[model samples]
Target: MSGLRPASAGRGESGRYEAFDHLATMVAVLRAADGCCLFVNAAFEAALGLPRRALLRRGRLFDWFVDASALVTNYQAVVANQYSTVRLEALLRRPTAPHAEPLPVHVIVTQVDHGETILLELVEIEQQARQDRETRTLDQVRVTKELIRNLAHEIKNPLGGIRGAAQLLEMDLADATLTEYTQVIIHEADRLQALVDRLLAPHRRPHMVADVNIHEVLERVRSLVLAEFSRGLTIVRDYDASLPEFRGDREQLIQAVLNITHNAALALAERRQAGDARIVLRTRAARQVTIGRQRYRLALELHIEDNGPGVPPEIRDRIFFPLVSGREGGSGLGLTLAQDFIQQHQGLIECESEPGRTLFKIQIPLP
Candidate 1:
């Protein structure tokens, strides 16, 4: 926190720094002159359960809240250089949620060092602490994705040369004895190439958009999984018949669900031997769900639950990382790819695991 400056305060209007992106307190920087939001932290997103893009569309801070006349009054006063701070209580309305109640909050409006930039802080009287922590983890996930994308590119570049060298060596080897060595080299190289391919698959593939039926995707994965472990596992379906269609890439979604289900099946290996392995594919619709910053009126919730020896706590925090797998001989790219695909659709994926039960939840908004 040392030697860091506020984006709205010290810098000129040309470019603002995002100094508060990781904060636990809900804070949004708005242009006091026009009352337009310039920046918002993760806590703000959690507190309001609204997307930044949606907020930007609204064009004003007070427009999305209930009884926000005080906010407007404070904004005008701050922009006019009449007040440095203002505090009040207000009811925050969540219009997207069906039959939602007004959220009670303590609102504080303060002027930054820069003129006309008011920082609106909201303290949700009910669930401030929990919401702050969860949303802050989400913010870290976003940052982690950027780092993963850059690092994956770096790791993939040399794979081609290594594979090619192994191929050329195999071709040039004349003696059968030496050919076996080259064959081993070629085999290992190809394996690495395949692994690298999975790592790069999400970023390399083009996003194809179409009206996606999530049930169809699930059914496909279920069939494939059943066919592979035909006798050992029980895959159950618990889908909502009323789920509407949403726009997404069908193939990508299929692959994402498949990876998750397949991972569950593998984890249930010991349980399968016990003759009681079960994996349930449950689907429901959440009326008001927020993912990354977007609040959806309705989002499909897909739960892939398995009764296996749960994910080890040591690797739970890093399960989605590019190469962090729990099972032996696992590539560890499954969850990473699933996460990438979900994020592409303005969605989110979360997991909860304990002994004898592991649930992987996928939430994708219906457009």
Candidate 2:
């Protein structure tokens, strides 16, 4: 919890936790002496689904909480300069969803600046559980990445020796038929070496960053996909032209899109062998989008959607895992690498699949 910085009373964080928009905890700063609201962070606004304009207009800072009397008492305690901190679980209402149930939150109130101002923190009960699940998933991914890197290195160590031995054996064999067996061994070794290299690739290379035009990347992928699947598939474009450029690795983004598009094309081909296969490349600006716990004001959404047989039920949950493949002879590293690249940009990839329809949605925050 060393990374946890206390939000200041007067105006949340005193420049410390001010930029901690990623925390799911809703926080606000208030004028302690008068019980007036001061500043509210992104998480708070997103949690309640209310704009700052509406929140501040609702009345006192603590008015959003259900037990107004409890908040009043808490504020009194702060103003009196008796206790430095207070905590309680409270039901918090949202102006946007008035008819719905109030959000259950664990609230914290603290006096700072010699009781001149108060800091309030609200952590949603359900969001905490969601965060825990996300943390567990991330930890599993970390462990898997390490495992892939280590295993790839282990396989690589003896790989060169095996391939070299096979080559030498091939040269020694006078019988062409027997030499063909040695050639098979060499070919397989080379294939394994290539796979191992791909497994180790992300760790070996440093990310290249530049201002990326998403449409340009999409266009490149579109052209490549069309060239490959010229006759069978129909690729449709649905783009929001107003989106702005953001910094990222252009090559990485291209690869991510390519891998997803390529997979969609394959799936489409399998489901509809007689043509009428359709794949859609969609781009849109997502406003006030929350990825995991963090809320971004603006984000880019790139969707590669296809009409195909849905993901196989058994492997659906493990689709992004390294070496898990739906298609026969599929490397299975495409989605894994695609996921890794997007995560490098503080982005996420989500999938939705059903009979005759499969969609892969990639989201990255736009600065």
Candidate 3:
């Protein structure tokens, strides 16, 4: 074992490394010679499903991985000054429960101060994949929103001209039958105008921000859906009363939730006739959650689940894309608008669907 080194003050103080605990990635400082752990952050402890004291007492960090050969070789190389940094993929063992599997991680190692120890960072493989997916999703959403807005503006300009021309033609028409044709043109043009307005609604409306009680929003959505699907539809509420209110746009949240619940009710049409339709609105508070690219200490998790046919596999990945629908006569803007509004509040919406069980989960950061 390497001899213990005394703290030299300033940056060498043990407290200095405490800031690493706030990071989402697992981190550890190790003695390169024998792989003894000198420091392990909160994320490292949580990822290993062990207490910080326990991990520190265990003495060596090499045993944490399923296979330590690769790590051992790299640690030695860094210790011998063969390389300044190294990265490899490994499976980290979890000893928390029976039959638990090891977690796949991308390991990064770099020499620390004095060259006696090295800093090790473990990035969860799933987290890296999620980060990539979020980046792509955000990029796509930005491009789609811009394209839709520009297209809507182009349509809106022509729409007014069409309606005005139709009105003028109706007034000058000598034959009553020809007036009917003009009226048809005017009516169709008005319908198209309304459609365009709906498409531009998110961009046009101002965000009315206020202190919002999420439960209140759910309650409002619950009542609206219940009233619409009064017969054979059971709306169950499973709420965590301890959840605190946060700043948000209350009306936008209400509409976002209402859209999902309404879609759930519509999907349960077959079960509604059999008198066994069910929709669940469940809420709880989650801690240390990563939403999109940022991590939050606390967030509100709201789940809208239904007992109905699952989303079609072909369109499941595109549900949040504008004008993508799985149901007949669906305008396909409900989920898209819901996503837009949730994103405005710096939150995320995810859906998991399977036969007889479809769940839409919304996570919003809380103060």
Candidate 4:
């Protein structure tokens, strides 16, 4: 009877452990003193790529982070404040590939067991961030394109009439001094005509969809920028060789990519002692991207990054709108047109900026 009793207790313990191990969501238990993880479910192990054995002996929960000391201090404060839950970003280094880029994580930390232990749950951030960016870019493109189309139409008829009236006055007027006023009217009309033409150009052109190779488009833009700014700037290519050809208008795509690269080059040109003024053209393949609430099988991601003084905060939010420029004497229609072209091809363009590093990402469907 005593031997049977011991066997029954052992089986019960094993059954309970197995039940928690097979849970759908990730869960972990840690020691309160130093935050060493004592138990981790299978889901937790798969998400973090950390085994139970390794985490069980950890000195602190933040020890596995690339920036461990800072993370620990920040987290300790959050817990000490008696906060029930806290959320923040954490960069965790992989055990095998410590030197590689740290994994970006959205962490949720909560106090458990009467503030004795802390529970940390992490979700990858890149995918969510990309989606948010795409949504914003698409919205901007749609709104800007509509505005450009409407404004161009509204200005075209009036501009033509003004120019015609100026010509008539110049022909009939006798006073030489009055001729200058008519000439001014004619010149202003011509300037507005030019702006209107640029605004209408994207919509007026017919799209020629072809099996376009994105790298080729990027390479062409790189060569053109290098030819003009070759004196003090360098363009770097970091393309993913395996990226497949996407169906898009070749000429329009080239124009779109060129506009972004050209803007970056111009920004770099205005800096003093801009060490290694560089624009990096990079490509990657993305999966499960949602556009307009519809999920895509594959998407082509092209990034144009620069190390220039970042975009001005004043006009950053309205950068895609026509006539909004950060530089003095700059026509801001370049990005507006670029956005229009990419949107026509069912793609999105987004920008992230900070001092010394700015990234513009273009994503298009791969089919």
lDDT of 3: 0.88
Worst 10 residues of 3 by lDDT: 1-10
* TM-score-better candidate, 2 vs 3: 3
| Superposition error at 243 for model 3 (Å) | 2.3
The model with the greatest lDDT is 3
In order of appearance, the predictions have TM-scores of 0.62, 0.70, 0.90, 0.68
Over the stretch 12-34, how does candidate 3's per-residue lDDT look in tens digits? 53465776777888989887677
Write candidate 2's Cα lDDT for 1-367 as tens digits.
2234455555533354565455546788777768887667777877778876677776687667777788788768867877778887889887788999999988888876556667788888886665565556566677888899889989998989999998888888888889878888889999999999998887778899999999999999999999999887888999999999999999999999999999988888754468788999999997656676577879999999998888998888688899999999999999999988898888888777888889898989998
Candidate 3 deviant stretches above 4 angstroms: 1-14
lDDT of 1 at 207: 97
Identify the superior model by TM-score, candidate 1 or candidate 2.
2
Question: Cα lDDT for residue 87, model 1?
Answer: 82
Q: List where candidate 1 sits over 4 angstroms from the true fold.
A: 1-157, 163-176
Q: Give the clashing residue pairs of candidate 3, or none.
A: none
User: What's the lDDT of the predicted structure labeled candidate 2?
Assistant: 0.82
Model 2 lDDT at residue 148: 92
User: Candidate 1's error at 97, in angstroms?
Assistant: 21
Report the C-alpha lDDT of model 4 over 190-306, residue by residue, as the tens digit.
998998999899878888878999888988888998888877788888989999887889999989999988989889975524457988999999764566557666788889999
